[model samples]
Target: MKRKTIIVLVAAVAVALTLVAFYANSGIQSPKQEEKFRIAKVVRRDLGASVQATGIVKAMVGAEVKVGARTPGKVVNLPINVGDRVEQGQVIATIEQDDLIARVRLQEAILAEVKAEHSRLAKDFERDKQLHETKSISVQRYDLTEALHEIARARVLKAQAELDVAKAQLSYATVVAPIKGTVASVNTVQGETVTTGLTAPTFIKIIDLDRLEVLAYVDENDVGNVKVGQEASFTVAAHPSTDFKGRITSIYPSATIQDNVVYYLTSVSVDNREGKLMPDMTANVSIFLDRRKGVLTVPNQTVQREGSKKYVYVLHNETSEKRYVSTGWKDSSYTEILDGLKDGETVTIGDPGRK
Candidate 1:
């Protein structure tokens, strides 16, 4: 019984010793594991600050045009349709020009008759003047002949003016595109008569797809940071993987309210040379504010603030050392370190006070 009691005592002492050794090893390994995973090295990289906003693709000023008929006439021929590419001065529609041509011909005939009458009266006036000089005609007769010649001249002038007007009306019968663009809509069809009222009746609507812009509704809080000539990038739902580039061209001063949130309209110039972008498409835009190149940066979570001062816990010989730093621009993932940090140094990524 004495031997058994001594053995039990020895086993209890060994188990307690083993447990203390295991706990001591675990405590020593904890810091090493934390340092391995929760630490980052300071490095030099390019950092940029940007503002995000939703936008819509739109046509620039004068990029969209509505072609209308200037004269009232029946649509005789409609040569263009929607999605058709039209050049400037190309005939898009033709009106019934038969009546117009007839009017022009009638004016021409009236002008010819007046010219002939004027020539005959000039001869009579010359003969009368010769008679008057020779005393073979009275002064009253000479004045009468002269008056007839002047009347004929005035009649000829009036007739010529009528002919010019008729010609202009004839030209208006043919509707031509004033700009080079794609036809968006055709409002009138063949056999439909268009009447010109206070405003010309719209016959077609055309849009210049190449001259597209983005109307980004930037939040009022971020409007101050945006300026003209700033570079921007955006993505459309149609082309999710493709990033379109542009520049800030303008900012509207008036604030637009939507659901109680005030926003300012910002115009961004788009390069749609590839022809992938379309008008009215929703866009996700990012306006780049400031950019820094080859600057020392640390992970954003590694920096901690105390009132007006900022500091980081840098790893020095396997121990965390508190170091305050002056920061420059901050991006989504990193912060630019302007002072109190060195290249190739490791810093804690989270609060060092937490185990």
Candidate 2:
């Protein structure tokens, strides 16, 4: 019985040792399981040095025109509404012409009567001159006939002027488009009374959508980077995924202030042959100052600047080392590396201090 107890005690001791060895192995971590290092590789990419700005799309100068009435009358006919396409010389609106027509008829009748009287006086004056030459009439009577003819001729001319004035007034009642464009706004409706006083009443506003342009307000600090003929791209809220391309056509010489910040207005000429772009749409623009193809670049966050010197941490074989680099132009998220870094080199970031 004692021999059996000794065998059982040895088995119990072996089991305890096995449990302790298993726990010891599980509690310890290998060197590979220690703090891990995050790394990124130097990449070759096409980088664009650009200035970002927010601007509004507008119609180019002379692309928009306001159509107005020149005479005061009730709007009798408005054939076009907003968004209607119009051609040059197309009748857009017409005012009440009954009064103007009657005035024109009255002036015509006055002109006709004056012309008849002048013709009769001219004939009588010639006959009286013959009688005076033949001593058949007195000189004063001949002179009186000549004076009457002159007075009648002047009245005829005056009446003709009045008739021309009346005709011009009648023509003013009709409003025609000055250019070919789309009607953007209609300020008057049929039967609305419009007056032509100091200022002509606007009947419709037209815009040439084919000549749409983007007006980008660049910050004053960045205005110097923008120049004419530089390539740019923009995205509108209506077409967020679609990018429209243009070039800087002009830059306003004057500066505009908004909330104490100065901005320069830049005009970008966009191609709207497809007619997808519209006026007054907000455009997020990027003007490319420079573009480099297949250049080595690094994440901006990986670079640390001390004075004029810039450097990044490079990782190799489980070790982190400081590498001073020379940088070129940089965009918002990346920096262009001019030198001191090779392609495929691992850039270490977010690691503890390595001395």
Candidate-wise lDDT, in order: 0.89, 0.86
| Model 2 RMSD, rounded to 1 decimal | 10.2
How accurate locally is residue 4 in candidate 1, as Cα lDDT from 0 to 100?
100
> Which residue pairs collide, candidate 1?
none
Model 1, which residues run further than 4 Å from truth? Answer: 1-47, 122-147, 292-355
Candidate 2: tens digits of C-alpha lDDT, residues 202-232 = 7689998987899999876568778999999
Estimate TM-scores for all models: 0.65, 0.66
The pairs that clash in candidate 2 are none
* Candidate 1 structure lDDT: 0.89
| Backbone-clash count (model 2) | 0
